[model samples]
Target: MSTLRVRPSTVLFAILAVGGVAFGTTCVEACLGPGRAAVRLARTARLAERLQLTDLCLFTEARYTRHASQADRHAAFQDHPAALEHFPSGSLMPPSGAANRASP
Candidate 1:
């Protein structure tokens, strides 16, 4: 009687190949899944347009930094001109155009 033996390297390769296949399947599903939601997304966009909605809010920590266009450059340092930003989002977004221009 002959016994079949699998090498450790072979087992590892087989596991990796299975994982690769699973990852590829997920990618394909993701690519195809968004098509089904296209209509719903379009409808939502139309609703937003009709309502004259503002830009999307990126942060919830502070009202000033929530929307890039609506940000108040001095709001972060309201307590003191040299105070460090209290909200983490302040570090993520750069100063808005109004802040960059020199006041005449």
Candidate 2:
């Protein structure tokens, strides 16, 4: 009876080769994925323009923070002027420009 034996180095080399192939595939996808999606993106953009789409909804946690343009400046702090933000999304989005401006 004959038994086939594989060397440790051969196993290591095979593992490394598979990893390198995976990394290369990821790099190729990263580079070309956007280009492939550009057509769909443009079509979506055209549809949005035709429909006069408003600001994109970012968070579903609260109505005030749902859409940036539609957010109320003081809604996040409605509970108290110095109240800590309750919604996780509140920390993610920065105060809108209008909120930072002084009222005349």
Candidate 3:
């Protein structure tokens, strides 16, 4: 059998293929690493946010109209810090009678 010589085009294609594979794998590794880290961090952040909300709720009551606090239903957030990138900005105003009795 005669030896076959590789053409310039073939050599270029082979180089491109190798480069693509290397870059593709590298990009995947770099991307996944940061993405997973972000997810874990987000989970912790969300937990902290929820805890803060619960703490606030524990010490306060909410009402939408001129009525004594019933403590049954009120407005609630729809997203967690982990599942969402942005949070709605607003302060939960004290109910008509809600007061801060937390120890001084």
Candidate 4:
């Protein structure tokens, strides 16, 4: 009968691979339970909305000032009414007299 030979390095590698997979599986299961995942999604969506609001405000301010055109201002205002409602009055507008200065 021929003897079966198992190399030490091969056995060690198999054990490490199995252990790593198990550890990864456990971590994923614990971190991303259905409820936990949903909460994380909700938080991410809210953060995205806040960031989008900031971007819209900045863009509207730039368009309103640079062009000094009422059509562009109206178009930008119509784009994000919800963001406009969120901020206090004059928060997004340039400081008094700032927009009127012509760039050299």
Candidate 5:
């Protein structure tokens, strides 16, 4: 009887693939439920037109200037739902002075 042996490269590739899967699983498991729910609730791209959120979304997720801190900004905006019409209750808050200043 003859046994076949795998090459070194194949072994390395297999290890990397397993690592990637484990890492992805860990992330998904960690982010499910509340983390996922919060993202779904707080991700405002769908509200862009109705809420005039395009500009805000751009700045909120923008790359270089890094004006927004994901953790703190999400927390701040979640607390200040008044500026967003799509908030769960669909109740609106009158634009504050800062919001009014940006009015077109």
Candidate 6:
């Protein structure tokens, strides 16, 4: 069987083709990176503009309302002296009069 020999020009052409592809890919990525980032930023800005973050019920507000009303209920249960005894002072229960206080 005869041995096969690869020509220098053919090898050079193959190497150049691979190098050109790599360089072209890098150039395309660099060109599109900033454009992609700007698109994402614009989408985020549009979503923010459409949604009202401030109007949503705050965690603290919900917690305050829940605990304050609980305290008021506990206060009302004062007639049942045994009920107040179940929850010790400084425990999970808020202060008895917190329900009437102004919202922060």
State each model's C-alpha RMSD to the native.
2.9, 2.8, 14.8, 15.1, 14.7, 15.0
Ranking by lDDT: 2, 1, 6, 4, 3, 5
| lDDT tens digits by residue: candidate 2, 1-104 | 98999999999999999999999999999999999999999998998899887556678787667766666778888898999889998888877667666784
Candidate 6 error regions (>4 Å) = 39-104
Poorly placed runs, candidate 1 (over 4 Å): 97-104
Task: Give the whole-model CA lDDT for all candidates, comma-separated.
Answer: 0.81, 0.83, 0.52, 0.56, 0.49, 0.59
Q: After superposition, which runs of candidate 3 have C-alpha atoms over 4 Å from their true positions?
A: 36-104
State every prediction's TM-score relative to the real structure: 0.70, 0.72, 0.32, 0.30, 0.29, 0.36
lDDT of 4 at 20: 96
Model 4 lDDT tens row, 21-95: 999999999887877789887887798787763222333334453333332324335557554522243344543
> Sort by TM-score, best first: what order?
2, 1, 6, 3, 4, 5
- Candidate 1 or 5, higher TM-score? 1
Q: Using TM-score as the measure, which candidate wins?
A: 2
**Regions of model 2 farther than 4 Å from truth:** 1-3, 101-104
Runs off by more than 4 Å, candidate 4: 34-104
Candidate 1 lDDT over 1-104, as tens digits, reads 98999999999999999999999999999998889889998998898799886656678777767766666768788789998888898888776767666783
Relative to the unseen true structure, what is the C-alpha lDDT of residue 40 in candidate 3, on a scale of 0 to 100?
91
Q: Which one wins by lDDT: 1 or 3? A: 1
Candidate 5 on 34-63: residue-level lDDT in tens?
776776666655565567632332232322
Clashes of each: 0, 0, 0, 0, 0, 0
Q: Considering summed lDDT, which 10 consecutive residues are worst modelled in model 4?
A: 66-75
Give Cα distance to truth, residue 3, candidate 5, Å: 5.4
> Which pairs of residues collide in model 2?
none
The runs of at least 3 residues in candidate 5 whose Cα sits more than 4 Å from the true structure, single-residue gaps closed, are 1-3, 33-104
